[model samples]
Target: KMSKEKIDLLKLMGANVILTRSDVSRGHPDYYLDMAERLSQQRGLFYTNQFANNANIEAHYRTTGPELWQQTEGRINAFVCGVGTGGTLTGVGRYLKEQSPDIEMVLADPEGSLLADKVNGLSAKLPGSWLVEGIGEDFVPDNCDLSIADHAFTVSDQDAFMYTQALFSRELILAGTSTGVLLTAALRYCQQQTEPKVVVTLACDTGYRYLSKAFNHQWLERHHLTGDLEGL
Candidate 1:
């Protein structure tokens, strides 16, 4: 689900906003992606099927991957990220591997997502629900190249929210729920390493967009996140 602020901001930018069911699976008629496709067809509008779009992968591969390589001076040992449509994973992962095959491509997945298990070579499991939005998927999108993932980690909503809060309080960096999952996985990967290494993870979006969810104390309490904040 998207945050209220984001939805409002989109409307403020003059984009027509449409609400869809958050409870539906990918194949369901009410699923956001399916609904978007149906609406686009009915209205004779061009639909950007990001999940299967080569342009999505190519943009990240040509721009984001090269930028990271240049900014880091080619010393990066790992690239950590969450998979939404899979563009970033496949594109960046492919680019990084081409530059250096030793660079690790790490996957940070939400607790309820099947992506982590899929990376670990496990059989498909029924998808579960999570509080975090955008990153995790019930079904793996074609754009995502899971083969690039050398390691994977699953993060709970409690851990994601708590660490995201800490990122702001301690480091003064405002990040989103999905960023929390990436941060958690990156930290774990760093901690388990035997030697010093360069690691990279995404901030994704700002916390200002999630003020009513991850940044709300009352909402955190209601979701049982209050207790786990200290544990993290």
Candidate 2:
């Protein structure tokens, strides 16, 4: 469901985009892992294995984490996000924890991902499918440090999509699919809190990247996901 807008945006930014095809209709990090492995073995290509790259963590630690601290005026009680490379959670979580160990680093995982189960100290679920993109994994990435997360929330695809549409209706912000998953978890957590807390989650990417699928009403019906639109 890669939209032309996102591809064009990346090209405009001078990102050397290499297009590839996959048989998967659901999300796949293993596919990326396989590609990375192949590219690594090729002499001319240098592979920056994102899953294990410390730089990913450092980037978030130096920039994203500090910005959040400053933006919230040091009053942030929780940091919630989806785990893609695990870089954001690990890097940002580490930085925030160093500032205040009591700060909660929360994980928002799609239903089929093993991350939530891993975080909650429960047995992992059998591999399955979820429609959300950019985050969720069947295998743990080396870059992710689960020790930093204090809480984990698992969201289903239907709920995630509904929340995504709701976000547009309510905030006039068209965020990506994973953002919906993260926000759904964050909102659920916020509602369960006994006292008020300053919580934050990332708008992971642009909804413009998923126009053909998530934003299409017909796509939802075809996928049998329309029932939960107003239900969840």
Candidate 3:
């Protein structure tokens, strides 16, 4: 589900890219994460495993969380985020909670991901598929801390893409699909509020790389998203 522009950029940076099956889960040999780990061992390469890496969480705790607090002047009331490596959620959630325990930590999970239900205390179900890249997982990574979340929202691919297009048209913010998931859940959280609150979310990626997929009308049509996205 990654964009061609991103792949091209990686190639341009002199990285040997390996394309893996996107449909598989973590344990499958063909899964991207598993393949990367296996290949790294064989090649004797240092694999910075983001899922289990403490540095991933620490980076956000020291940098992103503090930056948000500083930029918002500590008036921020809630944080909305999608889970990928879970670094951002756990790290930022910990930092913000330390500053103010009342600050809500919300999860914006893709529809096919198990995280939303997991956070909301629902019974487990088999994980499905989603088109948005770089976020969501069939299983929670070691870096993820679901207890940090106060609420969770599941975002479908159709709604995410539609809102993402609307964001560009209405606000001129070219965000990636994952950002769409955040936007959808963030807006929902804002709407349900009985009092005014300063909500925070990240425009985690640039939409430029998604030109042929999330940003492409033809691609949407082919995927049967056009009909659903109409009038957005």
Candidate 4:
């Protein structure tokens, strides 16, 4: 983790600061950049290159897409992903489209996100509040190519959380919030197609990071999302 002392030193040395908050945690690169720009202007300084380029984020997404294609023997016809900083969705979507022009890139946005509206050629509105993290957006990112997405699904936070728990209990693959959205979208897409089509969705991150938030029953009950775990 980055330390506050180092951050303060960097700021003292004229480094443009980009402070990320929970409000933009599930938003896109454009949202973070715009926030940074506003802060910089208020402080009478220029803030450029305000984008997330974490190696961990890039590596995971890049690896997942290629692994899926290889495991499915290039038969994957559709992919569903949730957009966070547009890294995973943009990188994987671009790669899959380049390999197969007809492949459908589906975006799984939270119910109140602007992404679904933007992809469907509708005017985007300010997003409503949601419990899900690391997916959905109040604004779109510059790197995200809406044209590459053939369809979009607006999933609810409750469904996303419930299915995420199901994934852990059934498949033993503990995935985070964004993955829940993707899985829900992927199932929906698969059921709609009559033909035998291989579809892929990401397990964006491990559920360990969300234990305190999503996996805890106490937290769920606090949010009025309590349910039977036996079926999960």
Of the pair 1 and 4, which is ahead by lDDT? 1
TM-score of each: 0.96, 0.88, 0.96, 0.74
User: Which digits, one per residue and each the tens of the lDDT, describe model 1 over residues 172-210?
Assistant: 999999999999999999999999999999899889899
The lDDT, on a scale of 0 to 1, for candidate 2 is 0.85
Task: Give stretches of model 1 more than 4 Å off.
Answer: 228-231
- Model 4, poorest ten-residue lDDT window? 48-57
lDDT of each residue in 86-165, candidate 4, tens digit only = 76666777777777889898999988888888888887567786777767766666556577789999898787888889
**Cα RMSDs, all models:** 1.3, 3.3, 1.4, 6.3
Task: Give the clashing pairs for model 4.
Answer: none
For model 2, residues 1-232, the per-residue Cα lDDT tens digits are: 3556677889999877766543442245446567667767877778888889899999999999999999999999999998989999999999999899989999999998889999899975675777787889877889999988999999998888888888887788999889989999999999889999999998888888887777889988897666544454
Off by over 4 Å in 3: 227-232
As for TM-score, the candidate ahead, 1 or 2, is 1
- Candidate 1, 29: how far from true, in Å? 1.3
For candidate 2, the clash count comes to: 0
CA lDDT, candidate 4, residue 232: 37
